[model samples]
Target: MEQLTFSSAQEILGFLDSALGRDLLLVPVWMRNLAYRLACLQEPDNTALLRRAASDLQFVGPDWNDTAHQLLRSAEALEAARRDGGLGH
Candidate 1:
């Protein structure tokens, strides 16, 4: 598999949108989860993307429980940051 690189949320969302438009099952679950994870990292304050990433990771199976938990934790931190006015947007 090629290394996935995403610099911005728009780029990540565009890639995800395109992948979702096609037969997503054709893509491996790991790849899909990785894309979502990267997107979440790019926009950590985006609760929707973070939750989506966590959900996708959970779907990858029991082996990913730790990672999924971490994503959820990150989402919680992001929420706290938002409430604290630490995030600009």
Candidate 2:
């Protein structure tokens, strides 16, 4: 595979908007550090994406995955409540 590089936050942000960006959090330390730096910029849109990435930090085991799903649901429920909208959590 060809090496992927980002010389600026814009490049990284663009990548994050792509399909491959779904694996952003699973990347190596250097890439995670880059994401952290990007998140620190406090852009609302990117912040939400960062939050979604954080939510994906869960165990792969079935039992653990269930708990993780519930945890993510709780967060979503809270956000929906804040917005006065929920599919019924």
Clashes per model (N, Cα, C within 3 A): 0, 0
Q: In model 1, what are the clashing residue pairs, if there are any?
A: none
lDDT of each residue in 12-82, candidate 1, tens digit only: 77776787778657668867876776777677778878887888778768988898888789888978888
RMSD of each: 2.6, 8.0
lDDT of 1: 0.76
Q: TM-score for all predictions?
A: 0.71, 0.32
List model 2 lDDT by residue over 1-89, tens digit each.
01234345555555555624576445554454455345434443333544554444442234445544554565565667767853342
State in Å the error of residue 42, model 2: 2.2
lDDT of 1 at 49: 84
Residue range with the least summed lDDT across 10 consecutive positions in model 2:
1-10
Best by lDDT: 1
Candidate 2 accuracy as lDDT = 0.47
